[model samples]
Target: MCRWLAYTGNPIHLEAVLFRAKHSLIDQSLHSRLGHTTTNGDGFGIGWYGHPTDIPFRYRCIQPAWSDRNLREAARAIRAPLFVAHVRAATGTPSQETNCHPFRYGRWLFAHNGLVRDYPAVRRDLMLAIAPELFPLIEGSTDSEVMFYLALTFGLERAPVAALERMVGFIEETGRKHGVGEPLNMTVCATDGEQIVAVRYSSEGQSRSLFHSTSFRHLRDLYPDDPRILAAGQNAFLVLSEPLVDLPGWWEAIPESTAVVARGGEIEQYPFTPELA
Candidate 1:
């Protein structure tokens, strides 16, 4: 229903992926090949971490990404070592700026690319599950933001992957209670500035499209003359809802039911499944 990308690596301008990539997020906002909808014009947002702060700065609006001059200028001006950006497609939700993604809490930034099947029927149950302390911060009426709060309530800062598993389990359990057989569909990610934890999973085992870039070191080796790849350095990494470039060697599809943790210097995987007994 939406498209998102997260990057963690050497400091670089936001335009490198948001505007300059072969099939950038801006282009995807108007024409998405992998998203359920062609246009993700309902809204857009970006969150990035910069010098001297573990906290992130967020900018969001209910304007389509392709036509937003503000976004274009910001992308060209801001440089961050880690960032998360999203283009939204309204799916049974309002197009208010509050509903736009890349939601934030303290040092964490999160975004999602899919919906919770039949979310209206189960929204209350899900909302009630969020810790009472975090309930007031729920500014958006989208499942993505709910999921982010649930992760925080379930302990994201201390253990991100386990927190995600707990979040999914709670959603699945809550949905099933409301008779939704296929209740969850998502490819989501959250970052605490230093590390990124992303997951691709659904109750039915079939999830949304997600891929991670090959190591910049290998990419630099493959295209020695490419300035961008060389500039990103060996430690840079990217996880996207779809490949930015059409080339094969640069992107690898993440398999279904997987959680990826990118620690800048390395990428690690763990089998992901809901855990609620």
Candidate 2:
């Protein structure tokens, strides 16, 4: 339903990924090749962690990314070692700033690209599933935000994969109780500034599009003759809804129903399935 990209390992200008890429996130907002909908113009958001760990600078708008000049100017200036950029396509959700993605809680940031099929039908049940302590943290009425808080309620900070598994498990169980089948199509990214974990999964086994860029050192060596390659940092990694470039060895598709962890110069993938039982 939307397009997004997560970058780690580099401390380069935001424009390099948001604008300079051949198929940048901004371009995807106006013309997406992989998203279910070609246009994700409902809204946009970008979140980056600055030098201080206590806070992150975020800019979100209910306007199209291409139509905002101030965002373009800001993109050129802001830089971060880790960041997430998202372009949303509303799934019957209202177009509001609170609904924009990259939802934050403490040092954590999260975003999603999928639907909870007939979310309204199960919204109450899902809301009740969250612990009272975290129920107030939800500011938006989108399933994406619900998923975030559910993870928090279930202990995202203590255990990410397990918390997300519980979230998906609960959603699937609750949806099926209402005669909804395969109600989960989740391609989610969650981070606490120490580790970044991304998952691609759906109850139907066919999930959203996601790809990870080749290692920075590998790309730099391949394009050793290009000086621009040197601008990237040592651990630079990119996880996107679609390939940013057409380089043959520059990208790889994240397998269906898999969880990818990018941390400490290592990228690993594992088969992902939620066990509600």
Candidate 3:
């Protein structure tokens, strides 16, 4: 399993979410309280967009998120209105920079917090399903990256949610054919610089953890003296594999097999299920 977080709203330094929170992503990298693994030190990556540029900037390393000085410096220096950061725990994949999460393609960014059960059984079939144009773009050997490309192959750019549904469906179907009972286990987040879509799903109806922040106004009321909490616009939102803080009413767990969409501070959730491709 892994830990990841996605932030969208008013511009803010990455440190505010990456390092400053009570149990930030960096903290989760060292001591994950909700993940299957306690430590997620295999590798890490961050993807964010800057002003005047729709394409995101991505930085990934084979070093642990908590021990990387470069990541600290970058987090302190860069400010973005939207970003996704991940700390990997290597689910039978190589601990290389390319295997890190927050994989990117064009203006899209994706991160996953779970695994494809018995991936080896379905790897070949899954790879062969990716569009020829997208197959060459896969730079790593992780199921997470393959899932990203699979979603793209199914038209992620045109229909993010539907594409992911079909991708998951394909994965499950492929696994079933190979005799794997439970094929998928994932909490995935993807964005196109305009809207964010996050899903928590699994083939056996048991998924990894995923949470999204409640309205900023509620957070402000909970932390009246915290300037950072008060300064956030009403539209500010965060989605992650775990709650960043222990504050009650500040986070809501995404239901199993559900997709949450956030755009311009407005958030909506829909039931998600695999669709035959």
Query: Candidate 3 on 167-274: residue-level lDDT in tens?
Result: 999999999999999988999999988888999999888898999999887778777787777656678899999898887788999999999999987999999989
Estimate the TM-score of every prediction.
0.97, 0.96, 0.97
* Residue range 105-196, candidate 1, lDDT tens digits: 99998999888989989998888988999999899899889999999999998999999999999999988898999889999999989988
RMSD of 3: 1.1
Off by over 4 Å in 1: none
lDDT of each: 0.90, 0.87, 0.91
For residues 183-233, what per-residue lDDT tens digits would candidate 2 score against the true structure? 899899998766688999999999999998778788887877755457766
**Candidate 2 local accuracy as lDDT?**
0.87
The list of candidate 2 runs beyond 4 A from truth reads: none
* lDDT for residue 207 in candidate 2, whole number 0-100: 93
